[model samples]
Every structure is written in C-alpha cells, then in structure tokens.
Target: MAEQKERDRQEDDRSSPLIDQYTARNPEQFARNLARAMEELGKVAAAWTQAREKGEASDVSAAPIADMIKTFSRVSEYWLGDPTRALEAQTRLFAEFMGIWANAIRRMSEAGIPDHAEAPASDKRFQDPEWGRNAFFSFLKQAYLVTSRWALDLVEGADGLDLATRHKARFYMEQVSQALSPSNFLLTNPELFRETMASNGENLVRGMRMLAEDISAGRGDIKLRQSDASQFKVGENIAATPGKVIARNRLVEVLQYAPATENVLKRPLLIVPPWINKFYILDLNPKRSFIRWAVEQGHTVFVISWVNPDERHGTLDWSDYFEEGIRFALNAVEKATGEKQVNAVGYCVGGTLLAASLALMAAEGDERIATATFLTTQVDFTYAGDLKVFVDEEQIAALDKVMQGKGYLDANRMATAFNMLRAGDLIWPYVVNNYLRGKAPLPFDLLYWNSDSTRLAAANHSYYLRNCYLENNLSHGRAVLGGKKIDLGAITIPIFNLAAREDHIAPAKSVFLGSSFFSGPVEFVLAGSGHIAGVVNPPVSNKYQFWTGAKPAGELESWITNAQETGGSWWPYWQTWIEKQDGERVAARKPGGKKKPLGDAPGDYVRIRS
Candidate 1:
C-alpha cells in the first residue's frame, strides 16, 4: 500500500509539468486583473478621502454600490450556496459512476461485453471503436457519460438558482465537462491510444506541433479542426451559382442570378444575408444553393453580398446598413427589374436588419416591400435561448472594451462565442480528431463557410446587441433608426416567418413571439433542423421536416401543439407563397441588360478576408 501511494505520488508529480505547460499563462492574466481591480479601488479610496476632507457628503453612489453587492451576492449564491447538498450530489454521482464501471469490469472478467446506449444519438464521438464493441472501452464511455450527466445536473438542478442564472451556469459547466471529456485526450481515447502505438508516438509529436501552432496563433480554444481556407475559392467550386453583380456600394454588392426558367415572376425577390457571416451560406453549391433554387422557381433573385468590414469601416452603424446596404440594394433591384414592389427575405441578423428597415420604410410611407419573409430571426429577443446569457450589462460592457480596442469584433472571437453555444456538437469532436488522434481536417462546405467568418464593425455590432438584443426595442416600437422610432406593427404586409426547432442562437419561441408583434397576417413555420440547415434545406434533399398551421397562437408551445407536420423542405412552401404574391410570369430578365455586369456572383467583396 505504501509503495502504491509512492507510485501514485510520482505519477502526479510527473503530470504536473504537462499541466503547467498549458496553464502557465493563466496566472499572469489573473494577476493583471487583480492588480487593475486594486488600482481602481485605490483611486476610489483617494477620491473619497478628498471629498470627505472638502466637507462633501458620502462615498460614491451607495445605490449603485448596493446594486453591485446584490449582483455579487446572487453570483455567489449560484456558486457557493448549499455546499453540503452539492457535495452530496457529487459524491452520489461519483459512486454511481464507479458502480457502473465495476459492473462492466465484472462482465468483462466473464469474457462478456455490455451493450448500452450511454450517449445520445447526436453524439458521434462514442461511435469509435473505443466505446462501441470493446468491454473495457465501453466501461470508459459509460463512466464518462455518467460523470458528464452528473456534472451537468449538479449545475442545472441546483437550488436557489434563477432560470437565467441556472442556464448560464449549465452552459459554462457543459463547456468545461465537454472540454475535459475522455474522448479528447490521447491516453483516455482508446482509438488514439492504439494509433499512437501503431505510429510509435509520431502522431503525438504531430499533435504537439499542431497544438503549438494553434497556441501561437491564439486559437487554442477553437477545438474544431476547421477546413483549410486555402481549399475554397469564391465564385469557383463554392458560391458558384452563375450570376452577375448588378450593383456595388461601399457596404454591399447586389448580385442578380441568371434566370434558370424561361418565364420569371414580375415581382423580384431581394435576399439579405447576415453581415456577421459571408453571403455564400445561401449560395454554397449548385445542389443546395437557395439563390439557384429561387431562380429555377421562375423568380428573379437578387442577393446582397456585404463587404467584409475592417478598421476602415469601423464607424458604420445600423443607419448606414439601412441606407447603403439593404435599402440601396432595394433601389438597385427595382431599377434592374423595373419592378416597383418586391418580395424580401432575410436570414438571421439580416432578418433583424430587414425588419428594422421595413418598419422605418413604413413609417416614411414607403410601400416598396410587398411581402416580408424572416428565416430564423429574432426581432423580439426576450427568450433568445442560451446566447442571451451574455446579454447582461456587465458582459456587454466587457464586450464593448474588446470592440473598442479592435475597432471591429474579431472574427475568431465571435466564432468562438457561437461555437460555445453548441460545443458538444461542434467543438469536442474535433478536439478528439485533430488533437488527440492527430488527424487532418476534411473538406466540408458548411464548415468551410462557418470558418469563413466576417468581422462586425464596432459601432454596428455594439448597437445591434444593445438595441435589439438587450433593449428589445425593435418589437416594443421604440427602436430608433435614422432618427425615427420604427414600429414593427406599422408594416402590415403578408409575412412568412420560419423558425428552426433546434436553433440555439435564435430560439423558436422568441421568433414566434416576434411574429405576434407584427400586425400583418403571419405564416409561422417551424423546421426540424438547426439555424443554417433549417434555412438552406432544399426540397430535393428530402431530409428534415417542418410544421405549419393556419393561424399561429400568441404562445409558441401552443402554436406547435396545433401545427401540422409535413415532410421535406420548407423551400417549396416559401416558393408557393412567393408565387401567390408575385404577378403574372413574363420573359425572364437576363443577368444584365443596358448596364454591364459589375462582376461574377460571389463578387470581390466576399473575397476580402478579415
């Protein structure tokens, strides 16, 4: 027993060096933060002393100080309240996990393997040889699954935590648990362990080098083995939908797709993709391109490709986006098609901006938009899912500091935040493949587009989160744009609202809630997939399904309860809706007429990297 203890101590001592290598930089950062806090406190103390000496009244605002204490108390309660109960829960879960492993070991000793579904169907990591068939590996997977659940439940089911506080707690806890999963480490992951033996540790060496490169590039937290940006080129393999740039501005480039059908709808369609990402998401490939699909549906399609902003465009605001971005594209589409009215579609943040523009336009007595369609958008952000965990004033202030320093929100930083929302699906699996197994990343079009992120100008991004996300002013009729309070209920056009059931960024309930604020007749559709997939689903794929009803209720859950399920994509339904709103078909307008083509589809603006 003494010798075992000695061996364990030796092993722990050896592990310390490896742990220190990863954690050495954290101490300095912590120290810097502590020093800054102390400095600020000192300044406050000095000011208070001066005020007291000058016969001025009390210290800095007691109300704000009291509020700060209350906030800290709430945070502390979340972390440290009911210590005994938390400890008991942890102990019970640990025992349960140990018992599971013991049973597995006993079954293994009898030369038998246990068949158990330890993970959800969505988690593909455990499908590896380590967890599927082998007895010992199956035990590890079960133990891991048990422990992960315990850790998550400990935070989620904790007492004295409000709904919002518990959600935030669980989100961070899940991230930590996922990052520390057995599948993400070389020794613990059986497949990687075998591979390491086969390659004589060469893979580990390669993985170490990869880790070094990532750390040097400051992307260590980006666990996914993202696609090589070099493999993709705009207007070539991806975003290859044949089209011509009809108009260009400092903020956007409007591309008009070549007609695929003989006769096209007289009313043109204008699509506004979120500037947070490049526009190619809607035009990824010919097989799945929404632009091509719309054109093939006998509709003249025009999309705005937003310029990837930089320090040069730091001062651009929402007003600029309305004036020079969507509104500008609207004018161009009208001029190019000679159609005074057009049907408009907005996806994600683009939807938010489009709704703002429509409200402002309606206020100004502009009736250019005939029909409005929103795809996975949240104009009313009251219940905007897990992303809102960081929407509090303190977090926003911290984000403000970051944006102020960089002039624009860094693409990597924003990507990291989004990835955190779905870490188990997107992050840990790649951590295992890229770092633990030392494998190269494959070429995936969706991931390539995900990695191909665009910067958000400081002013624009800050205003967006502050007003729409934080203030919820857009739906409340107090959202100001171009010095006017834009009211959502003012725009009474036919509306098609599509919300994804599994969207983490924009919750379906919030999207549904936003629909209630619109005075127009709304066709609220809920699709079965996530944000991107839900929007890009094509009828030809015959993949996921959607739910729709005659009239949606005020509550989302009730609407879903009464909604009817339909197989295949929502694109066909959207097409039918568009056709009904559109006028009689005419000879399809060519890509360009009097004016020359500015450039090819997925134009110069998309080529710019942040």
Candidate 2:
C-alpha cells in the first residue's frame, strides 16, 4: 500500500510539471498578454458606453427579453399560486437531485457507478470524453443535464398559459439552459481548463482580446466571428461568376450572367433574392454558386442584387421593391434580351414579395411573368417556425420605433435574431471556439456569406412584418401592395414551390400549406436540408435528397409519406422542370445586349457592407 501511494504521488508530481512549465518559461510574456487583454476589455467597455449614449445599442425594451420575463412570471404565478403544484414541482426536482447525489456517492465509493443522468446523444456540449470518464466532471454534467431538463419540464407542464406565451417560455427556457450549460464556463469545461492550464492562462488572454476586437467590429455589439472574414473578398474569390450589371436602380442592380453554352433558353430567368442578405448567397463560390450552375445549364440568368439600404433608402417600401426592384429588373431583362415572357425565381422573403407582385400584376392585367419558382419561401406565416416569436404586436412596435430613428434596421440586430433561432448550433459553438478556446475560426465561404448581413429599409421591413408575419395577409389574400389586394389564387402561372425539410426561417409545413393557396398547378418539392444548403445544393455535390410526389393538397405528413424520395441535388430536377416549361433554344445572348454594362458580375451595390 505504501509503494502504491508513492507511485501515485510520483504520477501527480510528474503531471504538475507539465502545467508548471508554461508559467516558468513564459511568465513575462504571459503578464504582457494579460495586460494587453485588460486594455482591450477596457476598450470594449468604453465602446459599449459610447454606443448606449449615442442610442446605437439594441433596444433593451425589445420584447424577446421582456416577453421572456413576462411569460415566465405568468408561469411562476401558475406554479406558486397553487401550493400543491409548486410542492409537486419541488419534490420532482428534489427527487432527481437526490438520485444524482446517491449515484455520485456510489461512484466515489465503488469503481463503476452508472450515471443517474445522461445528456441526449445529439447534445454536442457534453461530447468531451472527460465529461463522462472523470467522476467530478461526470457528476457536474449529469447534474446540469438533470436540472435543465427539470426546468424545461416545469415550463412544459405549467398550466394557464396561452400558446404564444407557452412558446415564448419554452424558447426562453432553452436559451437560458443553453447559456448556463456547464461547458460554457471555464472550470466546468474540461477542455477549456486543460487548454488554460497548458497555456498558463494565455488562452483566456487571447480570448479576451478577440472578444474586444469582435465588439469593436460590431460597433459596440459582439459580431461573433463564425469564419475568418479576412480570407474572403466579394468579387475576387466569392461571387466570382462572370457577368455584367446591365441595369442599375436606386434599389437594385440587375446582373446578367454570361452564358456558358452556345445556345440558351429563349425565355430569360430572373432571380429575386432577399435583401436581408446579400445576393452573393446564391453566388457564394463557383463550386456552390447556383447562378453559375444555372448559367452553365444554358439559361440567361438575371439576378436582382439589392443595395444594402441605409438612411437614404428608409422610405422605400414594398411598392418600391415591386416597382423599382422587381418591375425594374423585368424591364431591364426585356431591354437586355428582348424577351417579354420570363421565368422568375424568388428565395425566402423575396419569394413572398414575388407572390404579392404576381397578384398585383394579375389585378393590373400584366402577364409578363410566365412561370414562378419559390425557394424555401413562406407565403403563409402560420407555421413560420421560431421567427414568429419575434413578430408580436408589442415587438413590432418596439422594432418600428428603433427603425424610425435610423430609417433602417441595423444588420447586426437581424443577424442576432437569426442566430438565436438556432442558438445551440450557430451561437454557443462560436462563443466557445472564439472566446473560450481563443482560437480563430477557419475560413468557410458559406459562413462568410452568412456573416455578411444587410440592413432593411424602415418602411419596407415594417410593412413586411405587419402584413406577413403579424397578420398572415399574403396567404389569406388580404395583403395590399401597389393599391391592390394580393390574391395568390390569381397567380395561375405554373408554380414550383421548394421547401426545405429542416428549414427554420420558412418551415416546410408552412410552405406546403401555402401551396394550396395558389390556383396554379403548384409542384411543392421538399428538399432534405436547411434553408441555405437545400437551395444552394448543386448536382455535383450530391449532398442531400429531395422529394416530390403529389400536389400539396393534404397534410404535410401525408404528402411526405406519399412522396417519392430521390437522392442527390434537386438542381437537375429543377432544370428539367424549367425546360419542360419552355425548351425553345436561341443563340446565346451577350450581357447588356442593348443597354450599357454598368460593371462586373457582382456590382457596386453588393460591395456595400452594412
């Protein structure tokens, strides 16, 4: 026993030197880094203060946080108002804690004691081997998992809350649980602890410095770096598809991509991408560029590249978008290609606008658009996913008030909201990597495009929120644009509505439900991925599958059950469909056939950063 004890002591002493060596070798450098980190932190504080003073900081009165508190208060009232219910909740939690404690005791006493709690297999936060192998960390992980599940259960079991309130409570509970996960903390996370010790606290120093830099980049807010921004340039490597800006308007620049084939479809293709994000999402890189791929398929593609709006464009509304953006692009396409009949594609919010525009054009007897395609777009906001949580009346008013001040919503505000929707995936990982591990994220083109957000004009955004999300007017035919009520039924042109199965922004069910509103023969395709990936998926990648079976007449589940699943990208399938609509070939037309070329493929408008 004495010999075993001496051996264990020696092992401990040997391990100590590994950690001690970093401090001994670089004590002065560590001190200097720590001092620099402190200075950066001070700058972060000052920047925050200045932003608040200038009224540039996010409004604390926003409903997300406030509604979370209010909803939880109602939950508390439900539990606390009845002593028995509160006692039951307490007893349940207490029992779980007791079970964990007993297991922990057994673990200390014996060699192998089964965990009393286990995080879900899909939960990446507890993936570290030490979280399960080490008794101390295993206990902490299990305890945290147990407590968080209990908290969520309480919210789920709570009575007397409306559906909206319940949803808010659940979302907020998730946010809190994710934020408070043991892995987020320094000592609680085994990986962070090991890295800090190995580096003699230099990791934290570097992390603090990065935090300061990110805050500065966001202009007082932390613009979480998901990818190395330094690695991407808009026109050089990304959005590098050969094309020319044939037309430019105050709101949009119409880029006509050069044809890759000798002949092209007689009917031109116009893409209306959402202004909330840059058009480069579709043209991220040649490998993933949908625009480039479409051009290679022998189609004249004209994409509307919306200008990142500012105070100057605040007064622009949906009508302006319809007229100056879509209408102007249509007119430009005609002038460039001399084609009156054109096939149009709209993505996300852009699709929503295009649907409304079609309705208005129907009312005005304009039949220029021959066919329409919607990509992960939701006309009906009924099952709009978590985004609806931010669309209540109180929140809209608050957002409007903030937008009114600047004439446009800040890009970061929207980016943060989108990130929050998938906080477990998009947010906390970056928080751990960039700020905890003190490591720079690797360069990823998709992530770089995601980070490049765009501001929304005040009038346009406010109208969209009130009409689409708040009222669900577009689906119901109550949406008014250009002084005409929007009736999706009036859009009798053949429609191709694509919905991502895993879409959060525009849920598949929502899109399926929306397909029924169109009087045309709507072919709803369910792609097997999220919003961006499912749409941007090229045939060469063969990454995800897509489904197509029946018209979206029945429940989404029934359609999904009856649908035929096909492997590989849906791009070729869509191309076949487009050809079926109009297969007539014409000599490949040059960009800006009649009009003067404004600039290169990704024009000056896309170069504007928010």
In model 1, which regions exceed 4 Å deviation? 1-87, 101-105, 108-117, 129-142, 212-224, 228-230
1-610: candidate 2 lDDT, tens digit per residue: 9869855644453356434522334567657766877777787798777878877776634567887788889889989999999999999989998998898888887886668998888989988667876777887898888889999998898887888788888888988999999899878987777665556567777788898888877777888899999999999999999999999978999999999999999999999999988998999888889999999999899999999999999999999999999999999999998899999999999999999999999888999999999999989888888888888888898898889888999898899889998999999999998887888999999989889999989999999999999999888988889887779888899999999999989999999999988898988899999999989899889898999998788799999999999998999999999999999999999999966799898999998987
Cα lDDT of model 1 by residue, 219-328, tens digit: 32232447765677778989998899999988899999989899989888899989987988988888898888888888888999999888778888999999999889
RMSD of each: 10.8, 4.7
What would the TM-score be for candidate 1 when compared with the true structure? 0.84
Best by TM-score: 2
For residue 98, give model 1's deviation from the true position in Å. Answer: 5.1
Q: Which residue pairs in candidate 1 collide?
A: none
* Model 2 misplaced regions, further than 4 Å: 1-35, 58-62
